[model samples]
Target: MTTLICTLQDHRDDVNWCAFSGNLLATCSGDKTLRVYSTSDFSELAFSPLSGHGYSVHCCCFSACGQFLASCSTDATVVIWSMVSGEIEAVLEHPGRSPVRICALSPDSVHLVSGASDGTLALWDFPSKQLCRTGTVNEATLVACSFSPCSQVFVTGSTYGDLRLWDLEMRQLHAEKNAHDLGVTCCTFAPSILSGGQVVQFRLASCGQDSQLKIWAINKFNFGGYKMHLLHTLTGQSAPVLSCAYSSDGQLLVSGSVDKTVTVYDANNALLLYTLNQHERYVTACCFSPTAPIIATGSMDKTVNIWRLEDGCRGRDGKSVPEQSALTSSEGRKKIYLPIHLCIS
Candidate 1:
């Protein structure tokens, strides 16, 4: 079971995206700035708004190592900030006026990729902080991009509903397809690890305006080159799906939609688990924390909500959250899914 933990309220305008590194949280906003906070609700590790973007910051993500934060904005710029120093380490501007919809960092945090509404994609060498390559999709906008957990391949989703996979090392398109009937809003890759620390098939989840979420499986063990196969189409969202994320263990999948609800599903079984309908407005963005038992969501209502897992709700393996009773139940003498809200720091 999941319960709302904190209402991260600070953005003057709509919150566009939220991400977490360890217990630290980061949010991008339409107010043209980004803010970071501590999950523990303690002032010992909190800070005020960090404003430098010339336009709305569309998305932000912490690097794999959590040592750096990368954000993209409508100002055609991507800023890389050092987590240790709280200072701008580098600024990368896209070639044109088109807003960079989102950006992703390689698993090793050695490279960065940004996508724009004009269907342009640019790859940057983080060591030198320079743009090294570029590509374009057939659609009107590239809505999302994500690097595989293996750090070898990357995927891009387009506004016009196109999906493409690319080889990072070879700098070539690995696979391309028209993924959805409508615009693809978000995409996320499953973690590389499986049971017993064994590496197996690769999987991806993507949400779109079609009001459907699709899970794609990539079988690298194939004798031929790896190919994408649609594994499941998870439905129930009545409105356009805006954002989605797979839990760190790849057992649970969560998605936010224009329907003003957040849905969670059993990733392996594709069973609908829970729907969090707490947001009054469209839920724009969401992500799972790397080192915490919580997930954070951002919305057009200018607030971020952190949903935390109960102590006994998750499986001992830490991969799955067991199905709970529809009404209510007790887990180890504690009321499971006890609704609560907190404003900290």
Candidate 2:
């Protein structure tokens, strides 16, 4: 069973992305602000609604230790903020001053990558905040990027429907052309790595405008050869899929779509488990809590819904069970029951 525990209607414009650290939940919006909340009570932090971006903030991510946050915007800069005091630490501008579409930090928080609308990618040494290397994909707008579990390699997806693998020096290691028709919206690597004998394998999930969510297997051989293979293609949504993410255990996968729905799947078997329809507008972003069986979804309706998943999974009739719900706003917390239906698949 899934329960809607909290609803946050704080953003004045469309919410673009939502990310969760160990204890904090950060959400960015087209309102040119980022808001941070406490996972324990879903309360807004004192220094939240961080208004540091000159334009719409496209994406935001927290460092591994949750001490810092990085946000990229159409202002053509990636701003780093201190999580402790909510102060600006550094602002790294894009090379061509093009709008930044995405940004990601390595799992180890040693490296940070920012992708621009002009096809330029800038890699930075996180500790010192120094630009390390710059690369570009010809005539493509970079939208999605993620680093492997080993943190030695990263993958990028572009609006040209291609997925390119890169090494630490920003060299192209391999490329998969036409991976998604239309355009790729988001991609992420599983947090776990598999090693058996001489082969190391990694799993990746990507969603696109073609209304498809794909799972892939990337293998690294002992001889240093790298290969990518398509594993599963999921078509649970009727509209373009916008965002996807893997659970901390790598056992569950979740995705949001323009169909105004969120789908949860069993990652191992590629079976659709639950279909959640709560958002009134396009579901733009979805994220799983790192320490709990909770999900935070942001939408074009300018609201973030926080859902809690109970133990076990099974098909059930779509019905509403009364539960205590709290909504946080600038005024105060309001008590109400926001009935959220979950359709078993």
Candidate 3:
């Protein structure tokens, strides 16, 4: 394997979110720019300066089909862009002291949900361009909001260290938990495909200011009735974990932290990988390629690094040795010599 690094040199300010869709990468930055890059060569594909946001773009994501892009910002608005034409399709505004921190589109792409600093969650109908419903959860500023992979449920975490689940159909609280000891910075639900046979399990991974990554499994159906079991708690970094994602295969999880490193762990909570000690700044975001063994990380150091997992050792019989066993034997030491280079652009 060969490793190639491509420095995205366009943003004048810090990048908040980097999203991948097909062969395209969409980066939202504080520079007021939304850049699209070709994944094949990391070449600039399109550059569009979005002006509606009064301040920094906080978060962005692509639609499931890659047809649309949604972004939230300190400007107190969320904008949906049409990927086909690179045009702004909708601009959602919230008045008063609320600044949208996170925005997510439903699986159907017909609705949108946003969490704001005002501690209110709003559900909007895309075509109608009207607020369909609103839920209040005191005055705890929301840090992140995500729709479950199945699209029937949504979860939001706030500064009060609470995670609340909402049911779209009834617009009611489906489940709630104090998921973290400190302000919850991020939360992600496991994919439905990982639970076998389409029966989606309500397992979620969350991280917070407490510097702990906790996995909570929700096993029941009634509102506030699900059992919360601690699957694992990862601790090591000196700083808080800001972002996390599970590999498509559900066997690995990657997390980025303000500690300036990215750590990859197996499903059993063993530390399987780590990288990025060269940069002396915070690692803001990280994600696994939807179809590759590559992991991409964005950092406050103003660079993105793409890393590939290398096969450690091959037995003389041409079979691969387990990573653990490879680390324990002399032959394994001889077989594992170098880190494979990954080709990035």
Candidate 4:
């Protein structure tokens, strides 16, 4: 069963994004600040509500080892902060001075990519904090980006309803046009990689303004050719899907939507497992813990809800059967709900 552990109501404005590192939870907001909390107790860190960005902080991501965090802002820059000291480590200015909508760190922490409102993407050398290259996607406003498990390539989704793959050299390897009907909001790569013979495969989950969540299979062949194929389209949420994430084990997927609900799914089979309806406003962001059975979801209501999966609550192939889940709201009231299934298109 999934249980609502606690709710963090610290952000003053809409929570734009939420992320979980090994032991910490980081949340960004339209209030122009970022907050850090301890995953163990969901308490705000002493130096939290980090005030460095001049404008709304759109997205934040942790380094592979969780030593540092990078946040992008409408101020046209990405700020890197030291997780231990909670101080600014570096500030990366976008090449064209356009508002940065999203940023992501490579799995190996060797590279960083930041996307701008003007469709420009800057690839940076993480260690040196130097800009290596820059590229653009026509006139599309880039919104979503994620790195593959192997860290050699990354995927980017945009307001143009396309998902593009790029290598470390800032070269566009492949593009999936019209992947979503409307704009893409968020995309994430599964943590694990599948390898067989000369082919390597990776799974990706992306949600969009089309009110659909999609699973994609990205494959790399021996001849250095790449291909992308649609695996499944989930139409569980009635409203536009905003954010989606894959569990650390790649066994489960979670998404938050404009319908004020959060949905959890069996990632392997694209089966809906749970639909959490506690947010009073649009659910804007969702993330899975890298080291625990925990989820952090942010909403337009300016709160971040933390959920925990019971020790034995596994889906699909697991032996335990999920009957119901309980939610403990911030007001100390409890609510329970039965799981609802959704169709896979």
Rank order (by lDDT, best first): 4, 2, 1, 3
TM-score of each: 0.86, 0.92, 0.82, 0.93
User: CA lDDT of 342 in candidate 2?
Assistant: 29
140-239: candidate 2 lDDT, tens digit per residue: 9999999998889999999999999999999898899999999899999999999999999999999999999999999999998899999999998999
Per-candidate Cα RMSD to the true structure, in Å, reads: 6.2, 4.0, 7.6, 5.2
- What's model 4's lDDT at 220? 95
Q: What is the lDDT of residue 188 in candidate 3?
A: 75
TM-score of 2: 0.92
What is candidate 1's lDDT per residue for 26-77, written digit by digit as tens? 9899999888876656122334477779999999998877788999998898
Model 1 root-mean-square deviation: 6.2
Cα error, residue 212 of model 3, in Å, equals 1.0
Candidates 2 and 3 compared: the better one by lDDT is 2
Candidate 1 or 3, higher TM-score? 1
lDDT comparing candidate 1 with the true structure = 0.78
**Higher-ranked by lDDT: 1 or 4:** 4
Against the unseen true structure, what C-alpha lDDT does each candidate score?
A: 0.78, 0.88, 0.67, 0.89
Candidate 4 per-residue C-alpha lDDT over 156-231 given as tens digits, one digit per residue, 9 for 90 to 100: 9999999999999899999999999888999999999999999999999999999999999999999999999999
Instruction: In model 4, state the lDDT of residue 27.
Output: 98
